[model samples]
Target chain A: MNAIEIKNLVKTYKGGVKALKGVDLCVAQGDFFALLGANGAGKTTLIGILTGLVNKTGGQVKIFGNDIDVDFEGAKKSIGVVPQEFNFHMFERVQDIVVNQAGYFGIDDSIAVRDSEGILKRVGLWEKRRAIARTLSGGMKRRLMIARGLIHHPRMLILDEPTAGVDVELRHGMWEYLRHINAQGTTILLTTHYLEEVEQMCRNCAIIKEGEIVLLDNVRHLLTRMPQDTYRVTLKERISLEKAQAFNAVKVDDHTLDIEIKKREELNEVILRLAQSGFVITDFHPKGNRLEKLFLEIVSK
Target chain B: MKREYYIALKTILRKETTRILRIWTQTLLPPLITQTLYFVIFGKFIGSQVRSINGIGYMAFIVPGLVMMAVISSAYGNVVASFYGAKFQRNIEEILVSPTPDWVVITGYVLGGIVRGVLVGVLVFAVSLCFAHPMVTHAWAVVLFTLLSSILFSLAALINGIFARNFDEVAFFQNFILTPLIYLGGVFYSIHSLPKVWQEISLYNPLVYMVNGFRYGFFGFSDVDPGVCLLILLGLTVVLTCINLFLFKKGIGLKN
Candidate 1:
């Protein structure tokens, strides 16, 4: 069974702002799914609806085959969410926050405390267990949030922009921790603007644009769907616009031009033409299809 | 459902109690200072000339009223501020998403407010002994009325907190509605001293029953029957609690 199923989910806020327009999604059990979108692309709204924070205007959401509205308690017991914003109690200690979350799930104090300490240690926050949430750094706080979410050992975890303000080193560390958790059979649904992280971590991907799912497929399959190939050519001398245009290339900068080649043989022809024009090609490389490029291509249309 | 509700309620109440105790400088000390000033100004200076009305000393006549006032204000203030602060920080989402029932959330916050209210009331009662020798004419009535009033106001505060849009809104309700009701509830004087028209109007104010019932506990005398006071308080609590539970279930102010 799928860990989460969202079908025709719609959310329209007050004042005629339609945040989500019938989004349909299904996350298979134990799959690492990346939900990608631009700012205000309904990523947060979708998360809110799935977690029962935002009221759905219409549609159905199911977790573990249980309808969210009909079996809310059952669905919620299997899911945990780490929100995009730092939404923890500032005055609460790290240990207290995690244990309290467990308590909310009906875990007794002894079990909750044991689980909380282990999760905190796994997140490298055990030493700061007694420190207030506000006193922790942004990265540490995010880790604390992750630990709090995992305190009850939920089957599925949803992370919304978990690395938004985190430093690069901490972001990498978080990815490792999340990957380890995912490896242990916990399904992860993540939303992030960081394309590189999604490309590296998620096996499946969904891109949302204007409250609709623009694309949803295996991560590798989506990358392979790009028809045009991008080549970054470093020129010894800046070329004229007309000269560059003659070879079907666009000048990216003073000494670099991006050429889109449809056929692999066309690359040789373009380089030869550039060489004949006395333009020295210092370096040339093909740019792999990145999520940013795919996003631009899909959304711009 | 029962298990999760019980655990959530216990956790929320514990957290709130810890918050009040942790911020003793703000929550506990301020009220103590305020009550001491009331004793100095109203009890010693003002009561020196005023005679006892109901066979109790002037200072003793107002002690229960003042204690109830403190309890009501603090009970309402504590929950309104704490719960609104949780909402403002967005941490309330953690509780909302849990398996705990909506009524459990409402009851948890209401219990937290009552704990703070009753604690402050007890402390103020202890401090009042320094000024006047007041006897508890009916121990069970005093305790019962105190607990009922605390629960009633705490539930009221929880509703206020849930509906409050921001910190200013939380303070606005307490300042505008709650404080005025406390003062106008005959906290300082008897309704008999007022004109017939004003006295009739005072009977409509709910806080008047709370104060009069509480005073009756301490002195065995009241402007209204003790039974009437208990009935009014119990009725108000049931009605307010139902409204709060309904609001929580509907996610009225929380969906935003």
Candidate 2:
């Protein structure tokens, strides 16, 4: 069964702003799926409809095979949501915020208290349990929301940009924790602008463009479809601009070269040509994330 | 109600009660201080010179009205401010996204208001004891009026909270509407003392019945029959609760 099944989803705001126009997609159970969209691309609106925050003009949404319109309570109880914004009360204590969220799901106080300790510790916020939400830093606040979302132990965890502004260390820590949970058969649905995170974490992804699903494919297959690859090479010796322009190269400095190659064969050809030019390559790396380039191309269409 | 939904209601009430106690200075103390001032100035300092009405001292005559005033304001203020705060902070999404039904959510907030309203009412009545000894002639009427009136006001406050876009909107309803109606509800003096037309006009104000019915419970003296007042309170409670439930079901104010 799919974790989420959206059929003909549509949302038009009061002023006739069409946020989602007949979007159809599904995420398989236990899959780490990514929904990639630019700002105002209706990602949040889709999540809102799923979580019952926004009313849907037309759609049939199901979670774990339960239709939201028919069995909304069942669907709601099956998934836990971490919204993009800091939505918890600012004056509430960190521990209370998490436990109270569990209470709304009808979890007993004693059990919520028991689960909050593990979740807060996993999110690296146990020490700050007594602190007020407003006093926490930006990243800690996000983590608090994560802890609150996970308190109910929902089958599916839908995160809307959960780690957008978090530091690298904490972001990686969250990634590891998410991976651990996913391995335990918890389906993860994520929406984020960080294409690198998508590449590193998501197994399957759908790119939504202007309320439509433009692409739905495995992340690996999507990466394989990149028509061109760009690389930056550190050269052992300086190469003349005239010689460097063969592979559509741009000179970073005297000894550094940025190049875009059309095919894998072209890379070898460029390397042979560079070796022939009496310059050896010291280091080489991709200039940009592969998914980002594809996402830009898809969204701009 | 489902067992789980009952648990959710208890959680909301627990949170609200904690907030009421945690900010005692704002929620509990201010009402006591304000009612204390009202008792001192209106009941003790001034009522000594005024003649008795209905064979009862003027101080005792105003006790039920004072107590009712506190109950109405506290009940209205608690729900409006608490629900509005949840909206302003956007934390209300926590409950909206949960499996809890809309009715449970509404009942939870209304019950919270009742807790605060009754606490303030009891405290104000206790304070009134020092200035005037208003005996409770009917225990059942006291319980029913206090609970029902607070329920009505709490439901009204939720409606206001839904329509309010800012703090000013919240305060406007309390000040321009609720406060004036409460004062004109015969809190300080009997509506019978007013001219016949004014007494008739005062009957149109809903608070008049609530205040007088609650007073009837205390001193067994009221301008309107206690039965009629109770029927009005009961009818209003039913109609307002239906309106609130309809608003929640339709997602008016709280949802898109």
Candidate 3:
């Protein structure tokens, strides 16, 4: 069964802003899905419609077989959303925010209290349960939102830019936790600006541009479609500019070269040539976000 | 109501009650302090100088009106501030995204208002008793009018919170619209004291009926017929309820 199914979804705001344009998408149960789009590309709007936060102009949406227009309460019962912004009560303690959200879903207080402890701890916020929400740092606030979203234990979870401003260490931690939940049988639909997150966490992704889906496929397949791979390679010794140019490498510095490898075999061949020229390779890594390169490629088109 | 909606309703009420008691200075004490001053200045100082209305002492005559005023303000203030705060902080999305139906949301908030409004009303009435031994001709009318008026104002306040877009708009409706209506609703004096034309116009103010109906409970005398007042209150209550339910259904001033 599909976790979410959207057929011909459309949303046009006042003053003629077409936020969404007849978008069709689906995510199967227990799958980790990513919806990638630039700002104002209608990613949030589509989520809003599914969550009943925004009225849809026209379309059909079903959550776990419950039609949004016909059985909204049933559809809503199966899903939880952690919005892009912090929307919980700032004056309340961290635990209260999560427990109260459970209450909104009709969970008993006793059950919510019991559930929040586990959820908060899972999000690494059990120690901050008594602290006021506004007092927590931005990352903690984001975690608190995640805790609240999970308190009801819905079958499907939607997170929008969950780690937008988070530091690298915390971002990795979030990625690990999300992976853990997806493995535990909770389907996740994530939208993030961090293409690295998509590469690491999402199994399937759809790139949305101008309110339309431009590409949809397996994450691995999408990466393979990139015609070239850019790498920043560091060397133990400097190589002459003439030798570097011969291999079409940009001399970032005497000891560093920026090279674009067109094929997997080409990378091996280039390394062999550099080694023969007495330029020892010290370290190597992708120059930038590989998925970001493809994302820019698709959206800009 | 479903079991879940009932649970959600209780949750909303519990949260609201906690807030009222937690911030007693803002929600409870201000009305307590304000009403005490009304009993002191209006009933003691200025009241002594004025003659009795309808053969009742001025101090005793204004008791019911003052109590109703507190209920109106406290109930209206509670819903608008709390709900508007939710909207401003976007925390209202907490309930909006839930499975709780629109009626449950409306009931939860209006009940919260009634809780604060009636609590303040009771406190003010107790304070009035210390100054004057106001007669109670019909105890049921006192309780009935209090509930009806609180519910009406609370429904009205929820509408205000819905239409309000910013903090300034919240205060604007309370100051410019509600305050004028309550004061001119015959709180300080009887509608009988106004000129013939003004008395006719005063009947158009819904609060005049509310204040007089409540006074009818205490002194057994009123400027408007109690039966007519009851019908008007009930009718307005239904109208305000319909309007509020419609807004919630349409997600007016709430969803984009």
Candidate 4:
């Protein structure tokens, strides 16, 4: 069974702004899925509809096979959402926020307390349990939100821009923690602008543009779809364009060359040609993340 | 009640009570001080001049009215500020995303207001005791009116909270609408003392019945029949609760 299935979902704001235009999506059980979109691409709107924060204009959403309209409580119980913005009360204590969130799921106070402590400790926030949420640093606050979202032990979790403003060091640890959680069998739907995170963590991905799904496939397949990768190599000696033509390499200048490695061609073959042609290669690396290049192409198109 | 519903209600109630208790200076102390000033200035100092009203000492005459006023304001203020504050801070989304039903959410908030309103009412009643020794002729009547009044005003406050967009909007309702209605509700004087037309107009004001019913409970002297007052309070409560439930189910002011 699918963890989540959204069918012909629609949302039109009060002022005639159609945030979503009949988007249909599905996530398999226990899959680490990425929902990629630019700002205003209706990603948040879709999340809002799923979580009951935004009323849908039309269509159906189901979580763990329960229709949201027919069995809202059942659907709600199956999924937890970590919103893009900090939505918990700022004046509330960290521990209280997590426990109170559990309470909404009808967890008993004693159980909520024990579970809150466990989740907070896992997020490295147990020591700051007594502090008001506003007093926590940005990274700690984000962790608190994650702890709150997980308190109910929902079958599925949705994270919207989970690492938008996090520092590199904190983001690294957060990514590891998220990967650990996903590995534990919680189906996660992540929406992040960071393509590198998608490349590293997501097994399946869907890119939405202007409220419609433009691309959907496995990460590996999407990477394979990119026809070629551009490599920048520093040469040991200057080579004429004519001399580099046999290898399909472009001469940037003295001691520099840009080579496009097609899908059917191997980088080793290029290196072998350079060696036999009496040209030495000093440095070689892809210009950037290959997935990022593909992402840019799709978004720009 | 379902166990889950019970837990959710208890959790929300605990949070709200803690909030009110945490800011005792703002929620409890201000009402105590304000009611004390009203007792000293209006009941003692001014009552000494007027001597008796409706065959009772003026101080005693105003006790039940003043108590009802406190109950009304505190109950309405608690829910309005708490709910609207939740909205302003976007913390209401916490519950909106949960499996808790909309009715439970409304009940939780209204129950919080009732608790605070009754607490403040009791405190104000204790303060009134120092000024006058007004006896409760029917204890159940007093309790019933107080409870119903709190429920009625709390429901109204929830409606106000739903419609309010900012702090200024909240203050606008409190200052322009709620306060005026209370003052004109015969809190300080008997509507019977007014000119015939004004007395008739006072009948149109809903606050008058609430205060009158509460006064009837204390002294058995009421401008309107206590039964009529009870009926109006119950009817308003039902209608307002329906409106609140509709708003929640329709996702007005709560969902985008």
Task: List model 3 lDDT by residue over B1-256, tens digit each.
Answer: 6899999999899888888898899999999999899899999999999999888899998999999999999999999999999999999999989998988888898899999989999999999999998999988888889989988998998999999999999999899989999999999998878999999998889999899899999988898888888999999999999999899888898898
Q: List, in order, the clash count of every candidate structure.
A: 0, 0, 0, 0
Q: State the number of backbone clashes in model 1.
A: 0
In angstroms, how far off is A83's CA in candidate 1? 0.8
User: Which tens-of-lDDT digit does each residue in B1-256 have in candidate 2?
Assistant: 7778988999899999999998989999999999999889988899999999989998998888889999999999999999999999999999999999988999999999999999999999888888888889987888888998999999999999988999999999998999999999999999989999999999999999998888888888788898999999889889988998898777788877
Per candidate, chain B TM-score?
Answer: 0.97, 0.98, 0.98, 0.98
Cα lDDT tens digits, model 1, A144-218, are 989988988999999999999899999999999999999999999999988888888999989999899989999
lDDT of 2 by residue, A99-181 (tens): 99999999999999999999999889999999999999998998898889889999999999988888999899889989999
Runs in model 2 deviating more than 4 A are A266-273
- Candidate 1 is scored at a TM of 0.92
Shift of residue B222 alpha carbon in model 1, Å: 0.9
Best by DockQ: 3
- Which stretches of candidate 1 lie above 4 Å from their native place? A233-289
Off by over 4 Å in 3: A264-266
Predicted candidate 3 versus true structure: per-residue lDDT over A1-301, tens digit per residue: 6998999999999999998899999999999999999999989998899888899999899899999889999999888899999998888989999988999999999999999989898888999999999999999999998888889998999999999999998899999999998999999999999998999999999989888988899999998988889889999998779978987889999998999898555677888988888878999888998899999989998
Query: Model 3 chain B — which ten-residue stretch has the worst lDDT?
Result: B14-23
